[model samples]
Target chain A: MGRGMKRWMLWLPLAVFALLFAVVAAGLFRPADRTVRSAMIGKPIPNFTLPGMVPGKPGLATATLTAGRPHLVNVFASWCVPCIAEAPQLMRLKAMGVPIEGIAIRDTREDLLGFLRRNGDPYERIGDDQRSAVQVALGSSGVPESFVVDGAGTIVLQHVGDIRAEDVDDIAAAVRNAK
Target chain B: MAALCIALAAPVLADPSTPPAALAYTQLRDPAQEATAKALMETLRCLVCQGQSIADSDASLAGDMRSLVRERIAKGENPASIRAWLIQRYGDYVTYDPPLSAVTWPLWLAPIVLLAVGALLARQSFRRRPR
Candidate 1:
């Protein structure tokens, strides 16, 4: 009887390992949404003092977020391809008198200007986030994320990924809600 | 067959180049704070790679998080407050050691449950065996 118990006990470690493996594999196969839920969603916008992309242009600061009306704060990078894909939508937003603030994440001034020049600059003020600190503080998942901030500087909504044609309505509505 | 394998693997290897992975081991200014930083890193999940903690991952986001941990430790921020700040920004999913809530109760209980079941099975086998 002792021998039988001992043999079964030997397989216990293997069984546990297999079970753990299965659980881990299941998590891997059908993983949760790639977007890590942002804790900054319901909170106020994080404070930052990023410089302008150019010498004379105004930089983006925390105070600028509370400007009299609600606006969209767009985090972008010259290196991010999605930013290019969403350029036209941003342009459309700009055309509709929507104030678009830009954060150039981890990008050089020359590259940022070049990207803006090529993609049609819709930004009223663009901040150069050389270290990507401000972007991360805003709980942005990656480039092309946009936040709708009300006059009180509260973050109304965060839109992750490139804004598609279908996303314009939701984004505009969020902007309106923030107002 | 060899050509086919090479052709199949080419696209997988060909990805847009980005900045090199930051893996420099910055000397911890304080040895006492080092332990706390290590513990925090182990607890914090890599935001980019959800599968591994910052301690175990070499992803860029993990590297950035490690740097952030060290930076905060250098500035005299305690581990608990730093973790709390990250949790506030990134949510509870940012930590491996989450609260014992309904969402995590099963994960926390699984090992104990497995152990109990294993012991019961072993005992049953023992009782069924004849001398």
Candidate 2:
């Protein structure tokens, strides 16, 4: 190889290494989003009618979601620890007049009642999702997930994980926008 | 020796936490239908346990998914249609095999482009110089 070509070849390895380093550094600095954003957003809520988990409270149905007001649908279970953590925040939202609905996944009545008694019951309607059929149909993968449904029954937002104090405002904003 | 073997096998036989199999986890009676459902399940990514496919994951959600797949397949729905249904519900993330879309086109093209570049460079370097 000529002197110029040899000089170019000498830098090629360093160039390749720098390119890889840059890629790695970029990834470290700006990590890829690991959260799965549900595709069901902007789509109408799936049709489902679950039985009442708590007595006297009516069961949740697709028609109830379209009751001409935006509301929050929370998927939780007595077995999920995060549900307890989010309970206070859910109560806060309920007090704010954000009508909240509940889907109790794979939970018994006794456990659910105890959980509500210990924390606080803010749900307007609590549905029993014994087999996670409604949860799966809603594209919810885990407990403590919440969705903001507009008056038209379209899902405006899907918030995975527990509703922390910090997330309350954002969720409220989403609920408002859904209106 | 027998005691040691029994001790080792005891743990295997005493899995108390294993949940009862869901309705769909039970294979279809017809071997052909079961095979078809199994093949489709292997391609579905479990939303709960992201690492394992629905066929391999023991998550209750995966079982539910497996049941849905088996039921649909048994109803004579093709695997492609079932896959489409899942993709529609969960987006492209639910399938191990993502179809080529505008965002994924670069991934499909990069290998061929890289190979062509390498071949061109190799030819230039190894070509015999005119005497």
Best by lDDT: 2
Model 1 lDDT at residue B82 = 86
lDDT of 2: 0.85
Highest-TM-score candidate: 2
Question: How does model 2 score on DockQ?
Answer: 0.27
Candidate 2 CAPRI classification by DockQ: acceptable
* Model 2, span A1-110: residue lDDT tens: 68999899999999999999999999999998767667788899999999997988988999999878999999988778788899999999988889999998877788
Q: What is the lDDT of residue A171 in candidate 2?
A: 90
TM-score of chain A of 1: 0.82
The DockQ of each candidate is: 0.28, 0.27
| TM-scores for every candidate against the unseen true structure | 0.79, 0.84
CA lDDT, candidate 2, residue A129? 79
Q: Per-residue CA lDDT of candidate 1, range A1-179, in tens?
A: 47998899789989989999999999999986778757797688888888887666788998988766888999888878888999999999888778899998767777777877899888888898765677668876566789989978998888888899999888887888787
Candidate 2, residue B7: Cα displacement in angstroms equals 23
Candidate 2 regions exceeding 4 Å error are A1-3, B1-21, B118-131
- Candidate 1, B18-122: lDDT as tens digits: 452332146476778777788888998887778898888865456667877888887899988988888888878888889788788999899999999899978
iRMSD in angstroms, per model: 3.8, 5.3
